[model samples]
Target: MVDLMEHAGANPGRGTYGMAMAASRTVFEARRDCAALLGVKDPRDLFFVSGCTEACNLMLKGLLQPGDRVVVSSMEHNAVTRPLHVLSGRGVRVDFVTADTAGLVDAEAFERAVAEAPTRAIVCQHASNVTGTIQPIGDLADIAHAAGALMLVDGAQGAGHLDVDVAALDVDAYACSGHKALLGPQGIGVLYLRSGLDAMQLVEGGTGASGADEPGQPLDRPERYEAGTPNTPGIAGLGAAARYQSAHGAGIRATERRLTVRLREALSAMDDVVLLGPAPHDESVPVVSFTSPRAEPDRIAFELDRRFGIAVRSGLHCAPWAHRTIGTLDTGALRIGIGHGTTDADIDALLAGLDEVLA
Candidate 1:
């Protein structure tokens, strides 16, 4: 990856036919690797974007027209909510299906939301970023399709951590961040669109050539959505990360799950601590959230970092609706995320830090 960046930096004129062909091959290979990771058959169905936020925006803005009705889950990150909020301002009616205290969105509530209105799409997260709850996306997609609404999943927290098969879920659109569970470089994201879905292009610019004078006459498939110069270095890094994850994802996931269970069990044992989301050993990603009755979440996070050399995310985590659903809107929780590299010693250190801080 570094070698490619160095080469591209030295020879800036990668726009030449030969150089362009090389670049195209690299980008397509990256796309193919990402698609394989997501269980997508065709690499062309996936489009690279700046990040998952942009990918979510492209799917939301590209699919829904003005005044279209969309149903979303309450556990969605701001990536889905903020765009829907913006679309709502433009006459799109957005309705939310509330989740239970376990951070699981009720399928019945989603069905009711879809049945109540003329829904165009159902937007949801495959897993809650704040609480690590894995949603029932397959059932939700079934309900959406039965109601004649498209199902869109934000897989930012789910992919690379969980076994994600877009075909099995039957979703129309899936968005994921390369930097999150994928352990890739920042600023790169992937969006997978179901075959035959005509999503209006969100951004338009030079896409090689189409032999048409009109700027609107863009190229087909991946080229149609990808405009301007691509992020070659970031894409290369993402591809490398995808390859790594593909090779050792099972072992990584097992380690993460074990650490998550240990952390959740320790926190739940604390009398003053309020553990959020599912039970200690539920089916979820390796994310644990909790709040202390006597200490502020930010203060706890600060103390942990300063006193114990531990880092954690605090507050709403860009999902106010998730907090609201879990009854933490007034006081956001402290979040500890486990990754592929998180060790048992790291989990022990965090638990010890929490004990000291709370005491």
Candidate 2:
């Protein structure tokens, strides 16, 4: 990754020189690795963007027009909800399937929402950012297909952690942050678009094509969406990260799951602590969120960081709807994000710090 960043500094997809070709290859390798990481069949099916926010915007704004409806889960992050809100002001009908207290969306309710009207797409997050509770995307995708609507997923929390095979899920589109769970650098993301499906151009600029004679952006596969110079170095780092995940993902998954169970067991034992989200099980990711009536969320987070040097996030986790679903909207939550580098010792340290904070 460092070597590629140091050497492949030229602009990708625009130059004819050797250095330019090298940069292009660097970017393509990133795309290819990320594609494999997500079980994407064709590398061209994905597009690089600033982050999942942009991907969400592209999926909502680019695809749905006025009066076109989209069904979404109430547990979605602001990235998906805010865009739909903006579109709603523009006459787009956005229907929501409210999740139960356990942060699980009901498939029958979702199907009922879809059946109420002509839905252009069914958009949802693959998992809750606050709770790490994985949604039943496969079941929802089936509902969308039965209604002849596209199934789009916000994979920011579930991309590298869960089963993300686009074919098996029949997902028409997926947007995710590479930095979150894919172990990639920040400012990089992928938007997976099924072949033959189309989203309006997110941006319009030089596609590194021969000429700009054609009016409007070219309606080609990837060129239709990807525009301007991409972050070559970031792509290189992401490619390396993707390759690393591919090689050691199973082991990493097991470790994360074990640590998550450890955290859940320890936290649930405490009298003052109230755990949020679905019950710990095999069908979940490693995000654990909790709250204590004895301590404020920020103070707990501060004590844990200052005393134990253990980092955890406190607040809404950028998904108030999720917090609401789990009955943590007003007080927010303290989220422990167990990642690739997290170990038993780290979880132990967190639990110990939490004990002190709540005590």
Candidate 3:
């Protein structure tokens, strides 16, 4: 693993004053590479933010006007919901689309919601953080566009786990965190804004350009969205991480699919186990979750960690609506988010731990 973030921050774009000028170039390149991964045609549309939360907040607050309604799926992360809630406090209304028993959103329901008058945006998670259920973004985009709403997808979980094409998906705006599946350093993330769509500025400050003006921000493509100093060191690490993942995506997805399928099959066959998400779709990646009748999720996770040395996340996963769809909201479920580095032996070890605990 190349760990650039672990090192001290490098000052970029500095002058004789040792100012941090190189950092701007570092983030600029990182934004470009991330835009490529996101299937964006113009790299200038990519903006680097503090993380996915800031990106989501930027898109949500910038895109919607007062009294405009936004539609989001039940599976959105708190990053999406929390901002929307704040917007609601300011008189913006939010409507929720329904997810199926498998925790995937119903494309028809999404269409219906967007078709309603006053719906300005339709937001959804590309993949559920808790259930790992992949949303049908391409189809959902069709519905959103047909209903005259722009699609805003939270790619926090999908960006690193799967191939994301903002153009093909027809999403107007998308946000992704660098730290999760991308294996990049925290404090760096990318937001892709569709061409021709003007996102309202949430804040204004120094953009390292147009010093001749009265200190107002530039109206340029990315500079309009980016205000103040960029995260150069984190962005450098992010650029390297994108290159690394691009080269290894195929092999990593292959390994994840194999291990996840094997684990899902074994768990699905158990007496008390119930797996979530699509039924092993051929193209799906392995980020499996399950509920056990004999053991609560947190307890099972604790047993796996303390006694079996297996790490897993257990809770509502910040998507209560997703858990509610799968009837796991009250108690939550065990989420085993497998990464490129996970192995067959790891799955087998987890299974053995479950057996011992459930038995």
CA lDDT of each candidate? 0.89, 0.86, 0.81
Separate clash counts for every candidate: 0, 0, 6
User: Which model scores highest in TM-score?
Assistant: 2
lDDT of 1 by residue, 183-292 (tens): 89999999999988999888877766554467484647887888777788888889888888899988899989988988889889999899999899898999899999
Clash-forming residue pairs, model 3: 12-21, 12-22, 12-23, 13-21, 13-22, 14-21
List all candidate RMSDs to the true structure: 1.7, 1.2, 2.5
lDDT of 2: 0.86
Q: On residues 119-212, what C-alpha lDDT tens digit does candidate 2 reach at each position?
A: 9999989988888888889999999999999999999988878746887888999998978888888988889999988688878988887557
RMSD of 3: 2.5
- Give the winner by TM-score: 1 or 3: 1
Positional deviation of residue 337's Cα in model 1 after best superposition, in angstroms: 0.4
Candidate 3, residues 39-136, lDDT tens digits: the string is 88999898888889889999998898789898889888889989899999999999988787777888888777777766788899898887778888
- For candidate 3, the lDDT comes to 0.81
